[model samples]
Target: MAMTQAVQPVIRPATQPTTPARHVTVRGRASFWLFGAAACVALLVLLPLAFTLRQALGFGAANAAELVFRPIVGELALNTLMIVAAATVTSAIVGAAAAWFVERTHLPGRKIWAVLAAAPLAVPPFITSYAWVSFSESLQDFNGALLVVTTAYYPLIYLPVAAALRGMDPALEETARSLGLGPWTRFFRVVLPQLKPALLGGMLLVALGTLSEFGAFALLRFRTFTTEIYAEYRLSFDGSGASMLASILMLLCLVCLALEFRVRGLSRYDRMDRGARRAPARYHLGWGKWPVLASFAGLTLVTLGMPLGMIVYWLLQHGDAAITPVEVSLPLVLDATLSSVGLGLAGAALTTVLALPLGLLLARHPGRIATLLERIVYLAQGLPGIVIALAIVSLAIQALRPLYQSAALLVVAYAILFLPLALVSVRAALLQVEPRLEDAARSLGLNRWQTLWRVVLPLAGPGLGCAAALVFISVMTELTATLLLAPIGTQTLAMQVWADTAALAFAAAAPYAAILVGFSLISTWLLMSLFGKTAVLGATS
Candidate 1:
């Protein structure tokens, strides 16, 4: 009953599935690779728990109650939560408003504003902490910490919200307006609701930023859990106090994970499909221009101007005394840089490798397990580097004495603390790749392994590279974790800078701090360039 073949059907061999057993054999090999990747990821995630179980479980009911129910603990909890909430709300409002202005409103010179908004990300919170510490010792309080962190971390919200606004459909706004809604009302009701997910996402990021903040809290004399944990570790040496504190901090992070899952429940970020984008009409600032300009300039002066000026002023005042990068021996500089780079690269590579399997698993076929894995990453991500480092110290000394203070432990901490960056980038990349391409490869007689290698790997290579670069940058700049777990002889640049500054050798620390900032700026530039170049180019056109 089939249609008759025309012109003798250009006869072909009937061997499409001739090797059915061969396909099965190929699948077995492919599955082997899949399992290998999965095993690696599992090991990365679970290895710390294996060693740290004793420390985590060591908190008896008494210790748990003290940590959870003590007045001091309650005060710290309230303070930290206040900071998180305040920072989250302010960052979301500022970042989203800035994003909306640049991406939607007829704000002039948006490109400049966009760059300005993102500039804060380049300034390390610790350096900014140092700046504020030098700016005013007495300004070191909860309010000061909140202000500095909000100013520095708000960019997290800005970048994401900007993208979302630019990608949004202005037709919705037009619909509300046509229905007799005034501009402000339409914005608050229609536009704001549409931006809720993006704003929520930005708030989550800001909340996490505020949660893990250590340097700022330390400088401000704010006894957030991070600074408190560091105090316990340094003051008590090898004690259960630090561990108990870290476990509590971990629970705080879990709460964030729970909120994100609950609030964003079943809400896909990919709500706006293709063809949903419409350029919003620009609003002329008119007589409000001067005020807006002045506001931007003032914020810029306070946030950017004050910090840089203080650091420079102090450096120049010290002259030949404090700035010692030039005075230090070449080998010391070389050694410090090498150690930092080596440690960072090792961490980045390991994290990137693990992120891939975890990312692939989540992207290709997500389930409860994959979701749990992702939540674990996010929870760990919110932990301060100091807490994680202390936990690592406790675990290594007790359960894995042989590995204590080894480079391996340092790398392990880095992987744990910064895995979220690599995971985010890898998962994002994998999701962007269409699944149909793999099926098409199968139709073309390629087995899963062949298809993954030929199609998937190549497509994901760039993103993985970027992820590694990001992790490397983050690890290189990280201070507390490296200080804790680095081998006794290790001298990373960050450690060197901290040591110099701790000793009041400002000149000595300058070069390392400057170099650290330079390297971070380079990587951040690359990251933004990779993501924002198209937007830039489109604007140009």
Candidate 2:
């Protein structure tokens, strides 16, 4: 009866769906810009590779083949492969064992042992070579190269593997135990498979480091592709030969990368259940505790104790000297230290900035394009510093004349060389940030830029810090690129150490080396303590 009065139902205006469309538009623009930025970064890193290829191609097929297939090339390749293989295997064993002891067992002083285990990374491989060479000339061969690199880089494996161990759910191990699996059997069957991604990534880095190593192999008199490439560049000043060699080196690195990627496959290792994870129970060492303690003690002594002891010993020896060629003056040491710190900060900041776009694209918009860009950036890791430096020198001389012989150019080289380091850490950090948080922020009417600036940046800050710190440590110890690209009179600590060491002025080099090592130690401690279980070396999947 009331409807007869024509009481029409009050209709609310249709809610506008413009918000989602606007969000989509903003996100689409952001992704487009991110792809552009990442593509630029990847192309910048590809310069060295492209240059090397061009130089190699300039040689006709016959000449290229001859250069590549010669006995010297074969010998260098053999030496490179042998050392990379041996060092990778040795590092894997030591790293996996050390991580297991520190993480899975109730070994006394486990925390101290963990720090000690990772501390060797603080000492650069070249510095380790110097220390070992100073300790005994017997170390100036393949065995010495093996020991030095293994010690310096095992921590690359150890850090990531330890992080994996810490994060792994214990339910699988418990199930294995219940099924009558022995410790060794369980580890071989279950734990090892879970460790594949981390282990493969670590091994890839180890192989690449060994492959591209120049300073360490040079100091040790080991003639790998890197050292030989350096010699080619130095002697001829014509990059044709060097580029050919670098092409071979790059080929080897690509092989390692491809194998690692293929072997890593698509297997996901995360836990299936959505339950709060408890810490894995530590195995009691019991009567084995004494032996485990002794082993860790020995490992620590070799990896950390020896390097520091040698550094200090050299410092004391230098202090007692009367007429050193390069006088180890307090002012000189301080100046070099300041230069190193300043350059390190610059390089770290610049590299992290350049790495951000690639990292972001890979993290949020992964696809064939993003994946290819990431691979291209990672290819820079395979480039020897000398190669990258020379490429930059050529690029600068030809086109960027203003940047030639400039610190800005050197910093750019650092960015190109270490983009992978920063990208890995940055991507890892971003992956930990839940995308839902960004979505929630958007739902609250925040613009895309606002969501990123307010929510994503804050969440990713620590990882970015870690990335910068990692790059800082690397740039501090970098030798080849610094040697080529440093503005004249810049005088970094690494340069000072290289100069003195090459001149056989070990005493003069000691002060610089000690200061460098000290900075590294402090940084390493911070990374381990502040970023607990964070894999600074990187991870796969």
Candidate 3:
């Protein structure tokens, strides 16, 4: 969902000659070093996929088939597929409509509405699940899971589509209007076709997200592959069963990725000439204004209001004034908050640092090797955190025993899980740093390392900060990997929320949930301030 900046055509004076290549040997050597570094990072990122494949293969084919073909597997598959399909469709419709109203129509306070639409990303899906379940036990089923995930993930589609709407050229729509086409016809025929890439990309993200989601479904008691895999691992330590399930989930995600990629095939919709383009005229709501406002009001109420209202309700219930009051400990809450902040900072720094080499390579030295390495990094996006945690646990126990159950090991898992997030920001940041600046630095007798340190890094400082902050927010809210891999006796806010919520102690969970939500909101605001609305897309997806 990261909006790509258009490439400005480089115009040179007619008298200026084409620049000669200088320091070809130095560049060649630098490229080789960068390639080696990036390859190592890619291999580390590929470990989970490799491990899953190995475990599945080690389970004999007949036995694996039997395990996968059982009635329970079929049931889980159906539930997972149903939820993924429903959520993807629901999110698309809701997201697209929200984007249309916010970006294409004359909605009052459109800017505020845009921010509010993406705000759900700040609330972890599990917290949303906790809120709904605490509100009523009857919601512990398919419908509950659908509602929670739709609210949580619609922004995955909305952000990208809205960004697309903002970037699109209005010339085609104007021509269609001139030809007497109705608004609906123009939208479907002209606008929809142009938005295909962003829309499909967003839908792909929603499907993959729903398919791999763990905590939310677990809390909701919705039996999906992720939940089943977690259960198999935790209850029976059934590595083969869990690996087989994970493999199936990964395959589904891959299919979505491939489908979106194939459908989007080399499409370029950028303007061809250096012509001035004006913003598209907003559609007047007219008599529909009141209804449209009501719709937006209702949306914000459900998506933002409900979970927040529930959290506050639970917080207030933590005393003798309420029935079944639970005593909330301020010390425990503060400890967990501090722990979460510490771990988030550590994980953010480590992940961003690990991602730097690959991002640099992709931005400055793109080729077959760089592209392949990038694709390998992105393959992690398809893997759920549970699967990665499983792989890391197994690898650490079997090979890296000393690091097993260590904070360092957990941080490594965070790096692998969220590397793409950091990479996207890093690459985008580096891309904005003109190569001409580096060339000039070199011409001034600065070495490659010195040029990057003194020139490039400073220029990319804010983006790098954004990258780290994005990862920090994710680490703070991340439940799956932290649950499986955090060091003994360590309790973060996410763990506390999950623990109390799982025990049906919603009041006890409120403090942690509130702090977590607060951090997310603040961090989200910082991201928007730094990179605008499109940056929020990278924060989650």
Candidate 4:
């Protein structure tokens, strides 16, 4: 998950003075301690990357050159870049259009359409690929990969752009219209420029997702570096080459982070006036309304309805019968559900806990150490699940053999991968808990630890809950790491779905998919309802 600059704390008015000197000293000491702890956690996050680097570098220069100079490497890079480029552009266009129609236009059923458009997010990309491929034999290619990723990830762009659109000051658009600019001209000249930050934030997310994606690309037969890496590991047993490819992917991730930063710049979009901002005027789309409605309906059908419908269809379908009462084998479904929930909860808690020190440090300190630690987490987030899994697998085999393939190690991998999601939420929540509140607690004779326990934690509860919910949903739907590192003989709901789908047993996979989607939707609902009010939806995986 990437951090959005939009979520930074608002600058107080000139009347509010800066921190006093003594207070600054106390904060500095606290920050140093927090920084130390955060650095340790960040190293854990980077352990996999470090391992990858070692593996890549330890292979002699000739081997490295051979790995790096191959035609396939160039092909994979082109494929990945193409997918990222296409998906980012397409998702932005689609997500922005959907947001504009639902948020800025007088579209009928806007609320319903908005929810349904975003509902595809609950359907994991791999699941969407499975559904699409199952529905048609021809979807096992680049076109299918592009389509699957665009629908699956467009919501990443949609939610942020929608939020930005909702909060926008409408005075510019009104002025542009008054100057005789057409709607399209006004949108391009005035509105789109203003939405650059949100758009870039969403674009960066889509890019990162595309870079790290393994399942959808793999299932669709689109050969990206992530899939190739998996193939290298599983089929060729070429750890060195896989690590090198991962290193290149990680470098690409860094380049993306830098590019987004440069494009977003340091512009502040805050309204200067103290007056109450009026709601944006809705455009009355008379003749065009039905067409827009139909487009959104089709979008929802492909993205959300089709996958879900197919899951249910296979769940009920039997030979020569239109519908059948599918008897879900209780033992299998129950055990899988339980395992999924347990891992999800454990991963959520572990990730959130690991995230806190770093989150607090960044919120309170805002220095090089804090920035570096946070970026390390972001880098880890950008790496593929397979890379992280391999890194953890390597680490466990070398340092903790007994924990190899154990649930404990799996949870550790989850924490490593999803810790940024928690950090972003926790840091945003911590920002809301003002320093003065903690100061008041101290004035009331509470110790720092007690103040954090009584004051900050309670105030940040919603953020923590949202973080947990996000992580739980992510863990429940995660397929890559679960496929590799899950304990022997263990099957989570996702694992079962992947297994059955791999075997082309669509009917057998249907129940697991349904259950997984149900849990994911519930958790996603919790995330949006809890954190939407707080504007903490940054870089969700």
Please list the C-alpha lDDT of all candidates, in the order they appear: 0.74, 0.84, 0.87, 0.85
RMSD vs true structure, all candidates: 4.3, 3.9, 7.5, 8.5
User: What lDDT tens digits, residue by residue, belong to model 2 across residues 223-290?
Assistant: 99888877887888767787778777778877988888899998888766848869998999889999
Q: Against the true structure, what is each candidate's TM-score?
A: 0.86, 0.89, 0.92, 0.90
Q: Best to worst by lDDT, what's the order? A: 3, 4, 2, 1
Clash pairs detected, candidate 3: none
In terms of lDDT, the poorest run of 10 residues in model 2 is: 532-541
Question: Model 2 Cα displacement at 292 (Å)?
Answer: 2.0
**Candidate topping lDDT:** 3
Worst 10 residues of 3 by lDDT: 1-10
Angstrom error of the Cα, residue 512, model 1: value is 1.9
- The total number of steric clashes, by the backbone 3 Å criterion, in model 1 comes to 5
Ranking by TM-score: 3, 4, 2, 1
* Candidate 1 whole-model C-alpha lDDT, 0 to 1: 0.74
* Backbone clashes in model 2, listed as residue pairs: none
Better of 1 and 3 by lDDT: 3
Displacement of the residue 526 alpha carbon in candidate 1, Å: 1.9
| Model 1 misplaced regions, further than 4 Å | 1-25, 47-54, 63-71, 265-273, 319-331, 363-372, 431-458, 502-505, 532-541
Q: What tens digits encode model 1's per-residue C-alpha lDDT throughout 249-338?
A: 777776886797788778554554567445677777787767666766676776677767766666565436653433566688888888
